[model samples]
Target: MRALGSNQAADPPRYNATTDLLERNLVAGRAERPYLVREGRTWTYEEVVEATDAAGSGLLGLGLDVGDRVLVATRDRVEFVFAFWGAIKAGLVPVPVASGLSAADVHFLLSDSEARGAVCDGASASAVLPATRRSDVPCVLVGGSVSGEGALTWEEVCGRPASLRAAPTTEDDVALWLYTSGTTGLPKAAMHRHRHLRAAPSALSRQVIAMEPDDVVLSVSKMFFAYGLGNSVYLPAAAGAAVVVDDAPVVPGRVEGLLNRARPTLLFGVPAFFDGLSRLEEARLPDSIRMVISAGEALAEDLFARFRDRFGLPPLDGLGSTEALHHVTSNRPHDVLPGSAGRPLDGYEARVLDPDQQQVAEGESGELWIRGPTTFAGYWRRPELTARTYSGDWMRTGDLVRMVEGRLFCEGRLDDLVKLGGVWVAPGEIEEVLRGHPGVAEAAVVTSDDGSGVPVLVAFVRREPEWDGSDLPAELRRSCRRRLAAFKVPKSFEVVSELPRTPTGKLKRFVLREQPSTRP
Candidate 1:
């Protein structure tokens, strides 16, 4: 949990005003206004300018040219911000790699991007080691000392003067490359331009978030991901607000303590953390919190309702992806449906299409396609994937959804739909029913086969604190049978302490499938 001030000054005539995205209002912003906070210290907008300038100048001193890819492997702390903006200011392409990437994934990114340099903290340092050993480059280290061959300390990265000009770059120049969340396989890098940063804050930040100058933004999701990058860096900077960064493991009690201490006005987290937080014992939200944003996965209706009842505000649920940059569809404060995914933000368009590629009706579920200024140019070095997924302005999202008379209802992924008794079933429907039960704290439904050719629906349940496993499985089964059709009911229920989850709180169904059967 470190606070890294990220403010810079205007570059020379070679640099256009737009190229210096962060330096747009360094002088205009209130000098004493807090721009960053960690633990007990705070950095003003003016102080951030010095730190940011120092980082950029230091990188330039390393003899790296413009457009050379620099790998940014750090957490949600100041070092991450410094390296990210520093490389951008120096007219270099910064690849913001995920913190939890494995050795193979790290090798793929470094080799694919052809990175010239790297900056990382303790968490990501180990992964970078093998990559550097194979490619031999300058590496800047943060947090703690690591015995490494190519590693340079953070102080070395900022050892230069506190004044440096941003490189002269056009709007279409490569700005950053965001690697996709690697739940499986080698992650693809989504290439974005210098101008792509504008659409996210304008549509999602202004129209949907309604971020104010006084707001203090806090995010449970780390900054490496596209969703976290927008809320943590883009939105907060655009609104002249402060950002709170914490790299610790996210838990209900730990999050509660941070909230009470920081008292952030805007809170952003995934559905998994929100569900747990809502069910915490004697949980009380901070008075300063005005909004809570849910994304990454579908937000369950039960968790949403319980959270709304506990806290006086309905969580602003939205849908976004690594390729889309940030949020595309979001719910506003005045208009929010309990289960619906809400409408797309201004400047973004969403169209649902059937298997034939023809458009579908508002209420009929179809594969989602989106087109907007925020969409990335394409995946790096993946022309076939790029061609298959993107066509002109529209990108096939691979998500199944229905507008349902103006409100969006996500019907899981296109592949998540399963066949049961000669009928197609969406796991969301059964999961929704299970979540409605008082004993259920969290639930997920997936199809599996037990050596018989026939596929059966299996339900995984995590019971709430108030209820033990006693009779809960039967109770949940009975509840689902009463509400849903007989064919849609789960074949068996497995009560467990927790479900398999990714680092970002997303469920890893592929991993769950490998576990031994708990069948009775």
Candidate 2:
């Protein structure tokens, strides 16, 4: 890990948003040092700085102005990173829309965020262009042919001068607007600023991952998601470490391949990705893998144990949201406790408060709230939501959790609980019970209406080959009845090939609830 400068307070806190941390650090390093890698090609720190500068100048020449929002809907390519930093260099806010979003969702985000421009890849460029047309935003096609009228190619933009610079940005100025995966409703844009970028490397980088200059970090999420963007792009760039970018989402086998090819010391992903990778029979992970970090969703203890059994390394679980830049609380590798998102990172404070906003006793579950440097400025254009979510400096995480010996145990989302006969029951508890069954590979429990039109618990099970779905539902129901309250046992069971999930690997319960009942 590189030595961070003094903790001593300086006048005005030395905040500079004109130049990105990547450019500043790269310019300070020797020109020949490798800073980025993609498909066996090495880009020196100086080369990366120059490439981003060229891309920035191109966007400027294309009529982008200060504070203009540029939407990046692409995979994890080296050029994608360049375009992202380029937007920063031009004083334009970069909004990374997920390339996998539905066409309607894409149109909604473009309109909602009021993006003035978009840069898209070949696969999604066509699908997104029509949506962009309706919003009157220009589209810049990258790794794709320009088909839409008035759309410009990435080559045209990069052809501009690399010497252009933008006016300085302030700490409070919005730099990015990331949309949260709308598991419940339409995705809301979480506003971030230049100062938020400084928090990850400062608080969570060295303490949790112990990142080193020689280390290669492989992020399993896309650059559009906050976790992936911070872990793979920002942290490595700021720490002067090497990062690997692949223009593909992390699949089960591809994750193992990337690990072997990059020989990364650190791997970051959500729990579902880890679960899928653990299921692979041929994944021979490199011995150089020193750390595995899990975030984006709560990790199951069984998944953690499976990882430990397979790789001999426990997956460190962290709790965070898009509202908070990356992670507010993470378990360090050496100090990790199973099922606990460890104590607050340095320079942050956390609390578990009851409905009255009073502190709860230890070992009691309450709403988890945090006050940290990485907390977002606010939600974009949603003053009512901003006031509801933010109280003074503390950001309400909307997660229900309990604290034991200062460690946090994620119970479930505050809204994920279902009322059965007037008693609150967490769906995760039912899912956990189903996961303990030997035949179950993956399980999701959701509250849905039965054929008779009353709210009933439904368990969707993806079973191993030997288990018969026909008989397993009854067996699992009996098991749950023995372990839980009679009313808490699932009244309906449906076998599914796979559960729908977001790009970040969170189970899409909203999608699951829309399915017709499989019950008789």
Candidate 3:
């Protein structure tokens, strides 16, 4: 890991300040390199530019205009990138809808975003078709079998022209709308401008990762998510580097294989992925990997130590949200303080503030507030939410953190803070301690009812295969009693096979709270 510094030169305004910037880079031959890879097939930047132009022309031919939203629900492939860039070329706002979403959830996103069109892969085309049809949005099927009417083939659309007029857009024009799962059940669409596209590469990429033009970057997440979109796609493109996209599920074995084959200089993944990869003690990775970035969830110290021991590099932990587009603060390899998210990157400012919005003293936990170029304009069509979250230019990240020596250490989410015996306790602290237990493979703590209808701290644990669960509950309670306040210890423990998690690997605490307790 490298230290975050201000040595990188300022990025040119042509990178993403305007809608036509990509076209200019293409014509100037500055973007002529391999941009996408799939099953040994590589698409050069020139080819990608040409494909985007044709796809943009196709969308324009369909009469889509600037600011019109196009929903994209597809697998990770070269075509997905083509459609993404193509929508930008056409001046259309592309909104990514996750394929794993339920049919009802999909419908809500399509209706809420008011998308005029959608593109989906074969596996999910059937499910997406009905939602699009109900919303009267035109559908285009990409990889899967498409027998539906009023649907266009992805191949046919990208073969139109090599030159399409770019949509005229300013720095404030919304370039993309990303929907993230919210605590309240429905997802929220965070609107990002063309200028926000430059945030990751500008602030974190060159400064922290120090990715060179020849470096290959690999991300475990998909491009649809902000984490993957910026780290995997935009960062490499902005730096004239290469990106390796594997259109497969991000399993531990597959991730190892990608590292072996691509020999990526940088790798980005969530904590769960790192934990899974750490399980394979015999798996050897290429020495070319210079940095490993962890985000989307708190990185446990145990996982961090295990990863460092195996890979000989500290996992650079960072905290980010969809509203901020990507990470606002990150721990660089050399300056990483175990369990700290590191100091704010260049051009960004962060502070811990109390509920009254007053800045807290150092080492005192408070809500994390951030101000930077990467922050999204607002949630799409939700003025109230925008007003509540955005104070002036600062974004109120619901997360709580404590600052020490200019580094931010995550405490937990405001929502995750529970009142036990009239004292607030962070579940993350308990979970972190439980993660250190030899018998525990994974753990999630949530406040729930005990059959008596009284609130209590309940812990769900995934024990190691060799651990005996019959006496595990008592053992865990005894461990907690010795290490934690009596009231803060869990009232009950439920040994589960696996804890439910989001696609990005964040523990779904809400799901755990809803689980039926075995204790009466």
Candidate 4:
């Protein structure tokens, strides 16, 4: 029996995101290479290393230590990166909050994470950090007035010596906490370890995106989101590729301008981003972008086909979560699928499970379960949620999915199903059919209770200019009916001038549902 399988198992890999993340690029004689570009300013790998060291030393000077959680809230991507790496180097866990979060939301995150310190940009100080009642927690302001506020300024933080002591850490050490997008409810912090940081980038940078050192990446997803964090930070760092930094909200015109300036080989965004860009009605694809990535929401089939028609390549629609640290499954450049999430990356296993947690048969839709090295350790301080979501080594992803021919297709959230006229209807199915209509640019479906409190389906849509709301709502309902079961057809369709979406491009369905009524 081949000596009983050699009588031993293989050892696990070792890595630390802090000390060793970008070091490979440095050691490979690429230290002098441009690692990042922003506002016409480029930083070499060596320069970033020095700044990271200085920032780490400054944080240490602020009296933070190992195991402390430091909340970093900043609009400056450069400053955010420095703080992120610096906190880890100082043996601290970095909590990166979205810059767009409301002050109350930011405060709740800080308080919930039990953070010992905060680093905020001066512009965001007023909104991100109020008068904290926790006197022990220091608020360090960057690009703002730090005087008398008891906050250390950016100038002071980077004033330390570049040659600073690097903290010793193990693969199991906590590196950072990414807050959930909160599309469902209040945001919760998802903690990831140093080793977890190394997993996704490996499969994504080297295998999926096939990152070349000369490749430039422009990501609309900010570092606060796991998708952004992996693409903007880990993917580039591990692959020795350069990235363009812009913390501004992703507008189509702005995105085009970024493309003209950055000349990136790869562009990253979410579903709504591509939808907005497609609405720009440009007949041609951006000249310089070789690839495009879409995540954060289901990539509608119509949007995908339209994008591919112009771009010459299908927009790689991937399904990732804050809990998984990034994309556990994604489309490969060679294996393009319009609306599918592609296959699981190396070192990850994915399955579809029914309500009973039993594995669903092929071609059946159910909740997605993923087991991977990149799976987050747990949600911070929510033991019950953690228990409900994680089973032993498997993490329960809230998104529902269907598998066909070894490809994974996201079907929106399992909870998004609507019971219409005593039958279950997937809003995603109706939305997909409606979006295929030439008159509809985008469509979002939500359920409202009927007279008896039986949930009824409603659609909020953004119509194409040609349609101009000229009886298009009726056409959309007809389209849904022709393609869907009677129960799946929306009871009502309202043409919203604009459908609400989060900054990261997730449709704000909860906001739509909270409306007094889903009506004209």
Candidate 5:
């Protein structure tokens, strides 16, 4: 078992993640330093500390006991930040879910987490109220319109004494629960400890990005995402740096607006957002951006080259998961492989193994397994599934990857591999080839059931605005034939306005697989 990064897992017996992230700034005389900048409003470290203190006290005053789970569903706003850290500060576990989920979806999370309390904005409240009503869970509403039978308004919560003492939590104590992106099935909550939060800063951010106190980070992902939570919240907090927050939809125009306004030193986004930025003619990346990190999905080599050609900087592609908390393997600033997820971070271990539980040779595809101090403890309330997911201390990441020269080239999900004519094919390879075509703006390949119930390859393509579909199907076929084997080429192509994606910007192949292909 070859491990790439250092092992620096030493920590104090008793630790509080929220306290470690926030109080250090004050102790270092950075009380007035900007912590969160949104629109024209800037919250200093002192201000955030005060607000989080009040929020913590408020949750405690609501009769919520220590170790209770609190569902935090809100946009990427200051209130969301306060509620999350505040819960941790008060010894409560915060389960942050995507705010864009439907009412029924939000309800599922509330019940699944067995939440004792919920903090939501108006939109999230609408999604949460019906469920909380049935469960009799206490609700605290923040920002925007507040309405619910027994829900406490943000103003009402803060009306109480605005002070709190950090909880006496051990390093191993559960600090938060992050739900997985349920692309394959229902989402499962990944339990993380206070110590896990402390490890990522040293492991990835500090060593890979060289994050410093004076830097400002702009993350296009919402705070609900594992990538966003690390990039926008804890990493910045741990570094005593500032984060730019916004609830705006991640369109190229809005992202450009943020880039021009925030002038962030670092920009964190997914491959889709990066692709969008590369397409927008007027999109401007400021000179202040020292690094751009891409994750959540595999970054294509063509997209990597196009982005580099358009902008002087190439995106440092990386791989991380909800189970891993933050980045496990990442491309460093100076040492980067465009299409590959670079070496393991400063304190993590990664390995590729075959189905027989033996290590695979270099350049051979296999399941990627990772183990680190910050790896999530277990799935909440699912012991059997957790047992199956872990092999000793190593967590099976479910990702298919090949290691070459210590860099990982991620193929796709293990479940996503399609077998056609007895040969298994990776959809990412076909999709990457399709994306290389000049007329194709975006592409996704999935196995769909034929009329006889046998699965066949179907490609869903979103054409560029200027493209005419007159000869695209034939052109695309030729493109695929030139680049891929006969068995790997998509059997049929379906031109669509948009490709289905999850809230986190991951392609929803399951959804695509279920939909029928219209074009032959």
Candidate 6:
């Protein structure tokens, strides 16, 4: 296991990610193998390469220069893949944003990225069109009528003969930009180099899953997210496996249908998605599925037991971030611990440290710091933040965790901790206890100020449909009293239809903290 700080050559010095991922298959005589399956259609490795080549040529012809930024706001489809690799092949930085963003949000991204052009599907064109127009950048429609003047359809741009030559990009050159979820504040762009794409597959996919060329993968997350990008694009390509792409929303019944149709050997989803699937009477894992990976947020122990009992395979919970390309630490297939995030991946190193930058004792919770080959170069245009986030090569993960018998157990994020009555409390501890109670489907804990401006804990719970709500709050309080300190107990329990989440299924805890507390 080699770390990035070591002076060794994991990848060649003059490497281009697009050229390497696509050309390797052809070199290995796998050009005819199926690489992408979407909506009943499949594309061979050869076909994908040609499409990406054409896409690169088309973008270069549009007066976009090398190193220019191109925003890709499209749904999870073949076209999104094409536009992404195409820009990278042309030596242009591709910034992929969520397809479902509002017009104003899209405009903000366009301006922040200073993108020279954009690619959008019909579903997202309404937002991207106005955003690109407002930003004065060229727009290319992927799969719909061109509604705006000067906007070109994908075919019109890439129909001509394309040059097979790829841009000269080194391993250290910026390949793409992934934006943070903005759970705490405004979104920040993390710049990843060409070599970073090769790191995750080697460490997590190859080592933990033992992924093989014959395996097929399916994910509920969209390509814009870092987790989804690894699952659908780079990881599969590196492993020489096939990926099933679905643009449909993640409904339990719909995912079940997709499972039956695709028969993927491995599935990737967030804990919330797995929880939803566990509730459906019609949901069952296809016999082909061998493992399930849970990410984007921590997986509760109760939900993990329920999923394992229902599906017969334990969900591998991992912790990763946009700063790292994908998972740096993850639970392996056969060595899973229900609530732990597992050990660091083969090529990554993790350490839990105190506020003074000294390593904490084992089993003592502290801030997590990780150093790995997949670490991002830095935040785009935010030098001060980047400086504060890194110490030499180690990147602060912003997560609070403890090491127990070689496994990493996450308590919560440092920013989410609530200081109640002069004692710091981890909300996850209270939420876990609340979730362990019967009929509690989901729980999120946030801080609310009491009448004297003292911070107090408030829990928002989503209960089972059949569970009686009469006196449930009092019962929940009693449950907490038995398991937690009095200060750690939530002062109020508010039952809601659903908790707020980001597009990628991450809890928007800030939204909960901002709402006026209904304290009694």
Per-residue accuracy of model 6 over 172-286 as CA lDDT, tens digit each: 7788999999888888999998889866678878888888789899999889999999999988888788999898888889999899989999999999999999999878889
Clashes of 3: 2
Indicate the residue-level lDDT of 64 in model 5.
Answer: 83
**lDDT: worst 10-residue window of model 6:** 1-10
Return whichever of 1 and 6 wins on TM-score.
Answer: 6
For residue 484, model 4's alpha carbon misses the true position, in angstroms, by 2.3
lDDT of 3 by residue, 1-520 (tens): 1001111344423223323434444645456666666657877777777887787777766667777888888777776777788887677888876666666777888888888788888756767888877777778788655666767777676566668766655555678888876654678888887778855677778778887667787899778888888776667777767778777788898779878987888889988888889888678779998888988888878889989998888889988889888888899867888788989999899988999999999899999999999888787778898899988998899998999989999978998999876788999889877877788989989989876666899999998776655688788888998899888888888989899877666678999899988953
**Which of the two candidates, 1 or 6, achieves a greater lDDT against the reference?**
6
TM-score of 1: 0.92
Clashing pairs in 1: 4-78, 7-49
Q: lDDT of candidate 3?
A: 0.79
TM-score of each: 0.92, 0.94, 0.94, 0.93, 0.96, 0.96
User: Tens-digit lDDT track for model 4 on 1-520?
Assistant: 0110011234434345766777677765689888878986998888888888888777777777776787887764787887787777777788887666667777787778777788887546766656343344677777667645466667777656667665656676678888887877888888888878767677767777888888898988888778888788778988888989887767777787778867898988887777777667653456778888888887877788877775676788777888888888888888977778999888889999998999899999899998988887777788899999988999999888899887998888877876655666678887888888888888889987656667777788888877655688778877877888888877788877889977566788988787655444
Local error of candidate 1 at residue 89 (angstroms): 1.2
* Model 4 lDDT-worst window of ten: 1-10
lDDT of 2 by residue, 453-514 (tens): 67888889888666655688888888898898888888888888899988777888978888
lDDT string for model 1 (1-520, tens) is 0001111234412432223445554755565687778997887766766777788778767778877888888877886777777777777778887777776777788888888788877888888876776788777778778556777777866644578777766555667888876665567888887777755678877897788779999999878888888878767776778889787878887988999999999999998888888878788888999989989898877778889998887998888888888888988899888777889888888999988889997699898999998788778788899998886789988888998766677878876788887888998888888988888888888877776878888899888888755788789878988999999988888988999887667777766555656764
